[model samples]
Target chain A: MNQRNESVEMDNQLAEFSDRILNDEETARAEGLTGELADLEKTVLRLNAAASQEALNEAQSKRMLLRLKERMRREQEEKAPFWKRFFNPQFGFLVVAAALTLFLVVNAPAVVNPDLSGTATSKSGVYVAAGVLTLFMAAYWLMRKK
Target chain B: MQNNSPHQQEISDEVLIRRYLNGEVEVFDLLYYRHLPKVHKRVRYVIPPNDVEDVTQEVFIAAVKALPSFRGDAKFSTWLRTLTNHKVAEYYRKRSRKQEPQIAALTETLAHPDNLSFHSVEERIYLQRALMSLPENYREILLLRFAEGLQFNEIAEAGNRNLEATKSLFRRAVTALRHCLEE
Candidate 1:
């Protein structure tokens, strides 16, 4: 049990040492690398520093900012009322869905009841509802495709 | 609005975020430029070079959308790093769905040992290849610890693990990385 305890202590010490090196805290000199384990520690520090340097693309930054501005503008427009939102393609799905629903309802009476009465027969009502439902489903599918 | 001066650099990310939230939308432009290199580097570590820009952009977009929900519990960079990881994972998921074989091919290319160069370039390339071989969690822990410079507690919180477990994971990750380099 004493040996196991010693092993755990050693592991914790090494872990702490690594943490310090990663944080750039002062530690033992690199010349202390006399064993395989020390060599590994040195390698780890070097690798850590090596990974820290990354190149940035100035051109990509400009392009990304431009796209972000456009997206933010569209988002702002979407927050406006229905009429204002209509100008942005970002709300095209909602627009199409509303349009299709309106079209179905407006034309439903003509197709369902030729008599032009406000009330329709049960069979004709089912047909009208089915037609509206079909149009809605089609609109949904089209929006998803877009 | 181009403020890359030292004084601007002194402004905290949280303060910048607050300013952006409050009417100064141009402050977001500063935040974007400030964090762009970090975001790009983090995404490049996990994603393919070709897709890095798209994933980085997606991370920023998601960050902007979710900014209102950010309650200042963590540093802005840490939050952004977590978002970058999620975006990279999502990118992989989408790619895998579209073409499973492409992921396998990409991994094989990354792991090709013969591609190793010499000097610091060789070391960096070898480390990157080894990192690619590691499990996603292990890679993320190492990146958070070493590259992003997050403390153990911060890493634990970001990873949803306890402090002790995060330390242990970091140790194991270093060991795994060493072994991978040896291979």
Candidate 2:
């Protein structure tokens, strides 16, 4: 807080400004600037080359994109399951179509070669599946109507 | 792309926004890099310095989310500047609701505690309270100027007000701040 220290601080500020002025003059001279304007021209390239700024460079951008994708995926996951895409009666015929696909998938050849004795006495697997599907369809229709 | 072309000399913010929406993400980066410094600076005025960077990030996040809905009734820069203002306002609202009571308690303790001596703490509290109590527009515009370095024209554009009105608003804000700070 003494006069000496105050003057030192002022000197530092002036030096910084003069350094800026000299750089500007050099640039102007290179560009063929003439007259007093050239002399006055001070190009200070305060271009910071040290400690590179954390710009949203490609890597950082990709990271951000990944984060966004992850957040969107999580939100979708928190929503209804994929099957609801079919069961969501708001989908109406689309739901019906998905249901039919699921039905086919569940009943399609499992190659289990059903136990021949278990098959006849227990009733045909296709018949059993048809019966179950009928019940599901009826219940789904009723639920949807409500 | 010509450096000397008159049409290309000034790329309207609207065009940049449209390019961004059309999948030119680099345009978004350009827009972000262009405005982030001012946004971060504004954030510091309302929030503490420590949280300003976080607020800056939040502003950009909000901008990206809201970009799809921007039909561009106004300039894109204006829209972003508004978003920054809104985010800053929301920061204050959220902090006051979540931490004001804790801060008040802390202040009382620090002021009255027997063993610990805290100097200049009361001034800090006074500054915070004075800022928070200002009408939202006044507090916001003043901060946007001093802290954000936005020109008066830009402030008017962002606030969606006329230049004269913006100036009057700033005048009113300074008057209120002076009164509050003095008290």
Candidate 3:
């Protein structure tokens, strides 16, 4: 046989041996197997037995699925739109507190000095907005660390 | 909890994937259970026992994340197997960075008599180490055949290679593994 034909023949033999071992172990062992094919068969049988012993049972699988679900949930939360995540209950309280503080800071200046408020309030508004954004970001970072 | 409805079991993976893409989020449970045993088995075959569950979870998580882009050009199982391969590779890459001795750890675990039930633990350790030493293509073919339980023709299809070439590759791979084990 040509090399190609010989290789094909070898592949066929290996496959047959494997199938026998996998589907009918008793009969496969009964065969007077030898050489590389026999070695391969023995390896396959051992691996199969080891794999079965190591299998994750239904309860373990279910527990894994639950863990996966929790992971997927957290992933979805992280991937949610920024504003949506910002409003999540964990951050909601902080967001409400920040918004209330921002409202007071922006309006307190105007109430304090209505005449000078235009330029003064606008200037303070920039500072207050920056400060609130920084505070919000710091809070977010802290929450993530937790 | 998995919904064990009889009709749910009847839906094909492709159909379930489509349903999942179309807002049927719960359909993923069917996909998960349908393929978990084989995926888990394949992971357990190659991964260290302590790390197998984590790697299996990584595979499904990746599949779930990548589902939207799944073009259905290949079977779902094949796609998942490819994904599993990537996760296993990633596990090794991360381990290489940590510089932990994988074989030593495996051997240590095997040393415990209660943990092993199949043939000699030394034989299994050698087989696993030899498997790890194989070239990627050879190792992949072996895993595809014995680990994932793909038929020879199916392996050819998954790899997009001609049957003759795949068969030849399989023969070569088995030879290499046998030689590795012998040494």
Candidate 4:
């Protein structure tokens, strides 16, 4: 047989041998098996050990469950309508900041025009504070998206 | 239902899933705890140790989202195992996008002080190192068969291969792992 066919037959034999050994089925001695099959059995034992390692303790499991609960809550909120979503305080803050920006822009001329002096500086200061707050909120939203 | 209660312990996963779908959300906690160790072990085989918990959590979250579509043709544990595998694969895809190091480097960082008791810490580390040297497909097949306790036919179905091909693949995978361990 060609090398490819030979190798496949060998693999088939090895697989059967390993299965019999693993299942503790009575079989003739494995005298004709290649050394690779013996080494493979040893490796399988070690791999099984490595794979079955216990990493989660009760406390860690509880902590993971808690996080999953929080995630489920967040996902549920995300699935809500826009109006429902805005009910969240974080979204409410964004909406309030957006409204303040619109109000300040519309009222800007009255507060800081050259036609109106004296109080223009203080009124402009108010606009500037509002502008800074709007900018901060916008930046926060952008950063969160990033 | 409270997980520790004797009543809850007697309920099967399918029954719990049905209850959860019927709006008894507390039943999900029982499912979560029931399958946590299985999911955790499965994820750890393919993912970096530090990321295993997060990936495991993501798996259940995915399961919760996908639960509505489940038709109960297979056991819930089988469905969850498939989901866990998908999440682990997704994690590797994301890591590759960010140009992270290879699996060997990730496995090297898996040596937490707490995991030393499974064997001599050295032997565990050696086995992990050997596993990291293997191709991803080989490692996955070995894990599904041995660690996940999948029969050869189940593995064939999962991988879309014929039973003989799957057995041949398993034998080759074991041989490759043996060579790596020897090295």
Q: Evaluate candidate 4 and give its CAPRI docking class based on DockQ.
A: acceptable
Question: What fraction of native interface contacts is shared by candidate 2?
Answer: 0.00
lDDT of 1 at A103: 60
Which structure is stronger by TM-score: 1 or 4? 4
- lDDT per residue for candidate 1 within B47-139, as digits (tens), equals 554466778889998999999888899879878988987887687778778765334535544665353223444455566667868887778
Model 3: CAPRI class: acceptable
Which portions of model 3 miss their true places by more than 4 Å? A2-9, A27-34, A80-146, B1-6, B107-124, B160-167
Query: What is the descending lDDT order?
Result: 3, 4, 1, 2
User: Any runs in candidate 1 off by more than 4 Å, and if so which?
Assistant: A1-54, A57-63, A74-82, A85-146, B5-7, B100-137, B150-169, B179-183
Q: Ten residues in a row with the worst lDDT in model 1 chain B?
A: B113-122
Stretches of candidate 2 exceeding 4 Å from the true structure: A1-146, B1-10, B101-128, B152-168
Residue by residue across B93-117, what tens digits does model 2's lDDT show? 8877877732653465566666223
Q: Output the number of the DockQ-best candidate.
A: 4
Worst 10 residues of 4 chain B by lDDT: B101-110
Clashing pairs in 2: A24-A42, A24-A43
The prediction achieving the highest TM-score against the true structure is: 3
> Residues B1-183, candidate 3, lDDT per residue (tens digit)?
355788887878999999999999988988998899888878776676667889999999999999999999988988998899899889888877765535644655667657664354455556666788899999888787777778878889878998778877877787887788778
TM-score between model 1 and native: 0.56
TM-score of chain A of each: 0.35, 0.25, 0.45, 0.39
Q: Residues A60-88, candidate 2: write the lDDT tens digits.
A: 44454455445545666667678764556
DockQ of the candidate models in sequence: 0.20, 0.02, 0.28, 0.33
Sort order, TM-score high to low:
3, 4, 1, 2
* TM-score of candidate 2 versus the correct structure, residues matched by position: 0.46
Question: Candidate 3 — which pairs collide?
Answer: none
